[model samples]
Target: MQRSVEGQPGSPVNYSCTHSKLNLLLNVNIYSSASPHISLLNLSKNREFRVFFFSVSKVTSSNNRHRPGRYSFLIQFYAVTTASSPMSASKCTRLSGALVKQLLDSVDSILFDCDGVIWRGDQAIPGAPQVINLLKEKGKKVFFVTNNSTKSRKMYADKMTTLGFDVKEDEVFGTAYCCAVYLKTVCKLEGKVYLIGSDAMRQELEAVEIQQTGVGPDHICGKQIDWANVPLDPEVKAVVVGFDEHFSYMKMNRAMQYLSQRDCLFVGTNRDTRLPLEGGKAVPGTGCLLRAIETAAQREAQTVGKPNHFMFDCVASQFGVKADRCLMVGDRLDTDILLGSNCGLKTLLTLTGVSTVADAEAHQKSGCAERQGMVPDYYVESIADLIPALQG
Candidate 1:
């Protein structure tokens, strides 16, 4: 059977779908921009399918009349035979072509991870800038959410601009900035912070008028007893951990001392164990440093990064973003996809970074409910895969 779904008046696109016993093929025609195209969607035999229509409009000036708002369709196929069906769980479907358009059209805001998503180290991923710029051009709200605490929001924005991405300081949310916000707004912390992080973290804390000590390196000196008796700052009321290249035994001992205080608060940026870089390389992440401090202090830290809900809360509270209409795109499943699950937002995993299809499949097959959250709703070979859809 065939069914037709029309777009808004004056829109140059039209969608027609042909349904068969085991497959559904959607034919889309963009008369003004391109020729007709067909997108094939597989429907498992004997399964039920539901189609949802979501309208996504582009903001245009009054003088612009060539392009009009468009409507995209999302098709969700399910196997109703049993509740234990694999399709009933996480769909880790490959996102491409029309699926990309449908997913993008369903959301107003898109949150992206910095490293491994857009760029790694100092290099921008191929075609990443174009994808980001085009998404903004299409009137989508784009924000960068990274667990790396090595850079402040302004620093992140500056770096993005250099990498050819059109970004603003307000749109970047690194753990450094969020950590400062958490202390000031949530904890209502008074006095100083015993920081075990980078100078960027110190800058962010100071920006919020939160005094912080313990930036740079702290060398080990004297005997083991002397280290145990290390002087503690009387005004330090909190211990904040982030990525520190100079992490040493002395610094860990100092953080434990501050955390030992009965009323001292403990916070960490994120628990990401590895920061993936270009060419399949990686380095120890901030989580390693945070774990060391936590072990020594014998206390768990209140993390303010992904999968913690506070990070999403920070974004939602600022821009009035609705969780239902947001998409979180990242390379890691444990942090990015889990954050989306926690926030009730759609998630897409890209292969350009950490985590693989095997990892996601393992989570999906595992009967554990907690592991299921790590599986993404959809995945793409790379964020660049969205470029074709955006261009269309």
Candidate 2:
């Protein structure tokens, strides 16, 4: 058993202050006959590990018969100490701003998102074309990934080309494409699916020879559902939910009823809780549907999205790219950033879409920081600014 005592101020004479902040320092002691020694792991052989002395307190041992002249133990303190100073605030701010330009100078691959960051609501954003051109000029590998199941990669490629950017279907990644791959490998799903998504999702389903039809008990019924049509199809063997418009209570009620039935499988594209709107107000994303379904059925749904290894496996196998060598770029933290980081690939985030640095700061302040969790290694304001930032 292990015990932790916190909120102690100052260091005892036999104790060491491992950190400048007293609140963070910890002292551990075991009431034993011998003092335990501490060894450093993964430390450089050239540099010495520091240790200092503080005061110690001896108390009576609770165990009566086993003790001999009162056992001695050590109240040892340990922390990851650093004599190296952090960069100046001014310098950090400047470097943080310049990080993207520096990255462009180093990294050879780039991935982009189609909506919001590239084209917002059918219109190309400013600097979108220039960024693509710049990447091409540098001969950097580029790909596009999106959670929008409303359009196929081919359609997205065509749209990007029409909007004056050079793009290809082979370089596109979408939730619909990922779902098709997941259906192919994981669950081996087939037959008619009761789709509540856009024409794009239906097209993909047909391409895979999966039947798309009206809701019925005979088919492997599922919904590529969005906000407006979360309605559960009672006959569906699988409940496939995606991003839908016009989401409401009726749709959720239907989804609940179907999911509550025994032997039904539930699937969702991604678990993004909120999405960006035109004026910056965030609307609940697919995660809202996921929770409702989970609550109704009292279980978790099988998700197919970024940072989900199924998508990574499909993409890596299809391209013959090693997961470590591949780089993933996206605007959303839960999906894009998490996907790359989870799959052992380099991850990058941009401020041009869903998440912002302010949001990241808020998360850190909330006391949820992890040593190796879902944070992007790099961040940029936009793809267009990447080159300059890298050069600087």
Candidate 3:
């Protein structure tokens, strides 16, 4: 029998197995957070087959108290060898088929989640820099997307550089930029927008020559509309949505009032139901606010996030790439994964964010099997694990 413990290299777990008469190999691969399961080629069964088990556990305080916190997944390949049937050659060959197929589907581009997958707030996860560098060295394109509307593209680029990752401003996409582009091309509002979100969002609106107003304006640019002391007017032409940290009941009421008016356009950056916070907590994202407005006004808002074809089209046009070739790697099933399905691109889901294996399993069992614009071809744990699969 052979045993192996595979995880990020140099992590707290030194990765050595102990057994009486067995050989083990520790193969470290960094897959994009897109894939849900860490696939292993089970070659231990050739000798003799007995029992196998899998479990996941967090690192103890004694280990390195940083990123990639030492998750040791043990695959115990047990073979109770007997004299009569010493080798089960057929079963070993059967196992090879499964691993090969899973590995063959790995593709070109790798998209990553900015928060938990790479960094927490301004802190980079352990091995994040190496993971980024490795992919770039191999000529694989790495794109990081975040729902964080608080920072500008420059802010993200600078922060990544500081964290030891080679990043370009254009490589990172934010909800604010997507919303701004959509508003410029679709709405074509030249007058004013009641601004919301952070300075980054404001800058994006300004770039499109859209004017800002306090009250009695043409449109409302709402960020955390629930928290800002926004002035409402009868002439408000549209209500735009994005991430808001200070969401409240009063804000919902104000948005409902504005949306109640006929001929008013409702727009949102993206409809991510929840955002990932440090320490593994869930917070409402733009989708939460969009739902409230839609429910109150009984109308749908123009969504401008991933999984929406417009965002994908804009990315292809701006980067000069084809949808069929690019891969959409994201954490959320409703947004990132959906973008691939909807745009005729490949979809990958990671467990580092909003959804889990159980959640994905339920989604699969519900008979929502790989439809045109809403299914993922693979599910991975994080971007760090995706590179190895891609290289092979």
For all candidates in order, the CA lDDT equals 0.76, 0.55, 0.56
Q: Candidate 2, which ten residues in sequence have the lowest lDDT sum?
A: 38-47
lDDT of 2 by residue, 171-202 (tens): 88788777766655555654345554556776
RMSD of 2: 14.9
The stretch of ten residues in a row with the least summed lDDT in candidate 1 is 29-38
Top TM-score prediction, candidate number? 1
What is the Å distance of residue 82 in model 2 from its true position?
22
Residue pairs in clash, model 1: none
Q: What's each prediction's clash count? A: 0, 18, 29
The regions of model 2 sitting more than 4 angstroms off are 1-108, 214-236, 246-262, 362-372, 389-392
Query: Every model's Cα RMSD, please?
Result: 17.9, 14.9, 20.1
* Model 2 lDDT at residue 260: 54
What does candidate 3's lDDT look like per residue over 297-346, in tens digits?
A: 67666566665556665566676655444666666666666565554454
Q: 102-161 in candidate 1: lDDT tens per residue?
A: 888889999999888999789998999999999999999999998989989999999999
TM-score of 2: 0.63
> Where does model 1 exceed 4 Å of error?
1-90
